[model samples]
Target: MRVTEVVLSVGIGMLFAIGTFLVLRRDLVRVIFGVIVLSQATNVYLITMGGIQGVAPVVGGHGGHGETAVTDPLVQALVLTAVVIGLATTAFALVLAYRVYEEHGTIDLDRLQGVER
Candidate 1:
């Protein structure tokens, strides 16, 4: 594999690891952040899967005629859609966290568990 792919693979792994760590924490906010990180990692992985050594998938764009490679536009579109969905999900999660904090007076999952509903 190329050096760039190797580097990106390592970075993706690191992000996954960090996100997992945050997700296992007791803090509700940290869990939300972890979910966001995981989503971003997924987007990056999708883009990397589309390959990085090609021109944009535009019609009659730069590069030779029918000789140069074009990056996968489908992957780009999927990532864009994921980004918008992720934003909405994040906002919803934050609102839920806020409501939990308002009702329970704490954002810690452990503390929340002890409180009666």
Candidate 2:
């Protein structure tokens, strides 16, 4: 494996670990942030799966180039969709959290769950 691949894999792993930890926290804000982190990690994984290439995947342009690899446009499209969806999802989560805070006067999971502590 190349250095870039190793770095990207490690980064994705770290993001997942941290995101999971934060999601399990008692704070709604932290949970929201964690979801964002997880989404970003997923994006990175998708990009890596497409492989690193210097040329675009265009027919009759660079497709005939010998020994040249073209980047997959499908993966890029998927990643772009994921990013937009992630943004929308994050915004929705924030709105929900805000509403919960306003109604309950607290963002703590335990407090929201009727726990005295």
Candidate 3:
């Protein structure tokens, strides 16, 4: 594992953590940006996982060194599915947020919905 790759992996992981934290924000705009960040982080993680050095797995060539570095296609597929799902989810969330804004003129959760005593 190269130092650059390690740094990139850590960076992507940090992005995911940051995005997750942003998603927990009460402001709707921050939440929307958080979702986008989360999606990007996931995509970056998938790409990083695919960066291993090895021949294509389909070749089935038995090299003497027997190094087991193969591209992780599964992660790629999972990331692809997740991106699509995230898009749909984001669209729905945006629509809901818009409705809230139309009805209440604000997207702040605490401001829009008062605490019930």
Candidate with the larger lDDT of 1 and 3: 1
Pairs with steric clashes in candidate 3: none
Candidate 1: worst-modelled 10 consecutive residues by lDDT: 58-67
Q: Which candidate is the best by TM-score?
A: 2
Where is model 1 more than 4 Å wrong at Cα?
Answer: 61-66, 115-117
Model 3 Cα lDDT, one tens digit per residue, 5-104:
9899789989999899999999898889898998889788777767656656666565647677777677777888888998898889899989999999
lDDT of 1 by residue, 16-85 (tens): 9999999998999999999999999999999999887877677675657567788888989999999999
TM-score of each candidate structure, all chains considered together: 0.90, 0.91, 0.71
Q: Which segments of model 3 are wrong by more than 4 Å?
A: 46-51, 56-68, 115-117
The prediction achieving the highest lDDT against the true structure is: 1
Worst lDDT run of 10 residues, candidate 3, spans: 55-64
Best of the two (2, 3) by lDDT: 2
Report the Cα lDDT for candidate 1: 0.91
In model 1, which residue pairs have backbone atoms overlapping below 3 Å?
Answer: none
Candidate 1 residue-wise lDDT at 100 = 96
